[model samples]
Target chain A: MRPIRAKLTQLMIFGVLLSMLAGCSYLNPKPLKPWDRDVLARPEMQLDADSMEDLMDTKIYFSKEASRGGANIGGGGCGCN
Target chain B: MQLKQTGRLGPALAAATCTLLSGQGAQAAETEQVDVTSLQYREVDRVNVDEEVIALKRKGKDEKRFSLKLYHDTITGASPNGAYFPSDTYTSPSGSSYSSTLAPITDERYAVSADWEREDSRRQKTQYGLAYSIELDYDSLGANWSRSRDSQNRMRTYSYGYGFNYDVIHAEGGNPVGLAPATDTTRSNQDNKLLFDFLGGVSQVLNRQGVFQLNYGLSLSNGYLSDPYKFISIDNDAVVDNLLYEKRPDTRLGHSLYARVIYNIDDNVLKGSYRYYIDDWGILSHTLDMRYRYKLNNDFYLQPHFRHYSQRAADFYSIVFYDAPAASTYEYASADYRLGNLDSLTLGLQAGTRIGKRTDLSLRYEILRQTDRLGEFPSLNASILQLSFRYTAK
Candidate 1:
């Protein structure tokens, strides 16, 4: 029952985001300039894209687990977590 | 005591996890004009008893690249037996037994990939590359291409990618379990092997408060997907023929979804991620991870990360011997943890800073422990310490 709820919560949030993405437009942000690089250049601000710290945690998490790389695990095995 | 201890780790863990995931109590760095690149090298010596591995990556600038990886899952060597633990022994905590033997491995991986990228502008970029690897008689060659477009000040982005891997598997070894003699070099039979992955996703700044990204991927594989080298234990019974072993599923179609969200408060950053996966091979998995990164000062910061992951083993998973006649010809061990309901708790710390005027370095230590969490469970513990250094020409 708990897992079912968690799964449902995931689906709901994901669904809402999908709809917004589809209907998105540049004006979502107020009066923008043509050459604005603030949003695009904010590397520290990236959501899914991993930063150095994120990658390190990911590698450790990945190394320690029995599962495949999740997205890709074609590489060799390492005893290191 | 055992039940009380395990139960205690639950809610406190969940609350802490939620706090981290929701991205609170952390500060975000104010941007400064600076360029950064990072590199890592790891040589694991646990060999056969473990698989040895080495990797290097450099990302930043206008181009990003990384390389090399090896997985000797079916590694040949002697194991503590006490570690990977065979089935049964739940009658009591100390009921299990162990022995040492010169064992052979069934799973192996040797792969490498190099990719290059080019930016058409701040809003558009393209990437393409090729990679190849071989395990046992199985070899794979593949290529991928991706395109990303930005909007809303790059606060939001969309990307799509597709790739294909053609694999070739050949049977080897005289041992039915797929182990070769200390001196046998015979290369045996061949079978069709192939896998495919397709991905699409979007990333967005949810608010001044945080950012979120989601991806949906499809994978199709036709060929040998079984673990010829893995084994399962039957219910507490050390029986005849040591319980027959089966191969992994042949054709598996799978889908994966994952997301990452980050929140900032002045000098602290909170990051979170969740992943959901399902495959036609009768496997489903879920993962949740979170971290709090705080800048202690200009040249240093302290970041502590915690993660929780859980998965349901493939339908064929077994705790041990099943009613033989009911098992499928392609049966695999319920003990094949790679296919079981697994939950992992990770605790980590990352600390580092800029050296002189043009050098940067950081150190990281992460610890992870896995639990079967099935009706009965087994544990495999692992840890890592990473030191990374980067310098750009002054």
Candidate 2:
């Protein structure tokens, strides 16, 4: 348990450091080209490719698991779990 | 409620279609999008849920959109009665077997929600929403608001949201009396619970083919947080059976941080995410999920997903409270497996393709395996299958 906690702490710190580096990278400008944006324009490229599917998956996970996160908002509660 | 919502959708769709067609001569402005989905969820020798959801969104000319959703669920199955493994025979209050005999329970749920969004400017958007859900013994009403902003170059984005949920919980036979040396209590009035959630995040495009997002979220809940129907076995050593009602703290605070990355290479897209969650109740969890989507062609794709999750038990979780005071075992305690230590893994595959210009179809199948701490119970095996269709009225 201690090792896992230590690893997670290190990972979190690394993630924060990486985020800082990325923030500095913003100074340089390299906009995506129209051709590059073609794939981005596709529905599949969107963060939530299928909103309804994502929502249903969230519900399933919530019911089965003890943890929930990385989604928009929480709605309803049930004893079904 | 289902019939009314279904009826309303027909007129709403017709009106939107009429509006779009009427303006076709001017410019083809897409004004509406509709999504309908159905899901079937099943667990081995356990519960099953069939759900249907319909969502409608209308985009106005002034950078504003209105969205509505109708959801219905039918649940049927036998759930654990919180007792230990059966040696002879045990029965529940509903006259069903509390152990391996398996008596089924049936219930239904309905939910409705509406939201409004306005793009305040080219780089900013704001949304507000309200929702309500109802079941036989529970009712919930909630509201939420969110805002997002994009950087000038579109390389970075930030978002924040807050939501509140008010729930009224009614035990079928009223609240249980004592926690230890369990005693019978009279039926009590409805109890309530409140939840508040706050979340903020940043989405960054690491490069042309890669993007990632990180988010921090907090949830605070208060009020009657115990499950009314759950019971804890007090004396496993004795042949005579004794079940004590469960009790939990009135307030809980939870925090979680998550990161996700999506990268595209050639004809494949890889998605990965990790989430770490902790709560005041001494439960900690880590989840890792990964997926790879392969494009078969312009109109078709296949994706394979894998997820691994592990969690520690809550501070007060216990399986059997032996020889406790007749009144209660402790201040906060539960036998619910969900609060106990466990690990689970999921493997799944999804195939989808465009049926035509306006319709698309997708199918998915997954298998999950979960193992608990005590190893007294068999590893739970669950399988899920989903079929979905999306249609656009052009």
Candidate 3:
């Protein structure tokens, strides 16, 4: 019973998030200007600008615990095995 | 006089030699960069790991690029045995016993991987990669490919990525049973596990200050998915011994939906992400991670990050083996705390600075705490520290 409820809740949240992502343009439809990209182009502004760091962080977390793949591609293996 | 000049130049020559040996003086074409990172991770009184990684990336004509990575890490100390008993020690059926804390273990891992990517003039990009990692008893080989396309106006981007991993697990010496009787010395066979991950995402440039992406992924793992070293304790009258090997469904299907947005406001960049994950093993998890990078001038930045994670236990997870006489007869059970209900919080800070025209350096520290432990296990706290440097040309 609890598992079912949890799955349902997760599904609902996923649907809501998907819808929100789809409807974002409706809320703010302004197109970015060329000059606005100056800040956006900064290395720190990109979510995965440091791909190596992000991958290592994910790998560490994956080995130390369970649950996987929240970010990019999934890797493999267990350290404790 | 020449000898005196040579002596005077010794310090300069030594400095030059040191710089060259550090790989900082290597010359590259306008389209290459090298990144080096070192990480130290410690789980208070549990495990310690030291890792070193070096990556080289080069760009070619027409936006084509290739990258290679060399990684190695040494891990030492004890890992949880998944056995719990009120007594100080609990013995398993294989004549092996462990304390309430953890089991002693050590392993070394190494991996080498390469990636190639290219983007055409039409804004269509493709990336492919292969990686292999080997440890003492386990080996994994993985391949991944992704393709993305930008909309006509380049305002929206769509991507699809597929990854597959093949792994072999061979226990050192021989595999032992979870709940073997005193007389049983059955050696288990090698186990194989295969995993496939599929991901699709749509990323949109929401104004110049922000970009948002929503990704949905599915992961399917088949074959021997349970930890061979984990055990379940059956404290029932029907079982003479309390230790039993854990058994899990051979197949697991997991789904994850993740959303992320990065917005740059003034000198600060704000990043936020949320993930909802569910699996057939009756585990559901939610993760929220956020970071803020505040630039203090044009050359340095400080980033503070916060992450929260929560998950429910697997259906067969239990601290103690308390099933019916017939069911307790080793159908399926696990005492691994990783599969139990838990919540964790991570707080981190990173500081980085640009040096010279093409060199960058950064240091990061994070502390993590896992609360709401399952069973009688103590809470977990860990810390990680990392330092990284990058040299870019062009």
Q: In TM-score terms, which candidate is top?
A: 3
DockQ each: 0.16, 0.38, 0.47
Q: Of the candidates shown, which would achieve the greatest lDDT relative to the real structure?
A: 3
**lDDT of all predictions:** 0.52, 0.74, 0.74
Clashes, model 2: 6
List ranges where model 3 is wrong by over 4 Å: A2-21, A24-28, A33-35, A74-81, B1-30, B87-101, B176-183, B237-241, B326-330, B373-375
Quick one: ranking by TM-score, best first? 3, 2, 1
- How would you order the candidates by lDDT, starting with the best? 3, 2, 1
Backbone clashes for every candidate come to 22, 6, 2
lDDT (tens digit, per residue) of candidate 2 on B26-140: 3344566667777777788888878877776667667677777777788898766565644435443333232322345777888888888889999999999998988888888
Candidate 1 per-residue lDDT over residues B94-203, each given as its tens digit: 45432212233334444555555567787888777677766665666878787889874656678888777776655454223322212334433665567677878877
Extract clashing residue pairs from model 3: B178-B245, B179-B245
Give iRMSD, candidate 3: 2.3
Clashes of 3: 2
User: In model 2, what lDDT does residue B385 have?
Assistant: 77
On lDDT, who's better, 1 or 2? 2
The Cα RMSD in angstroms, rounded to one decimal, for candidate 3 relative to the true structure is 7.5
Among all windows of ten consecutive residues in candidate 1 chain A, which has the lowest summed lDDT? A72-81
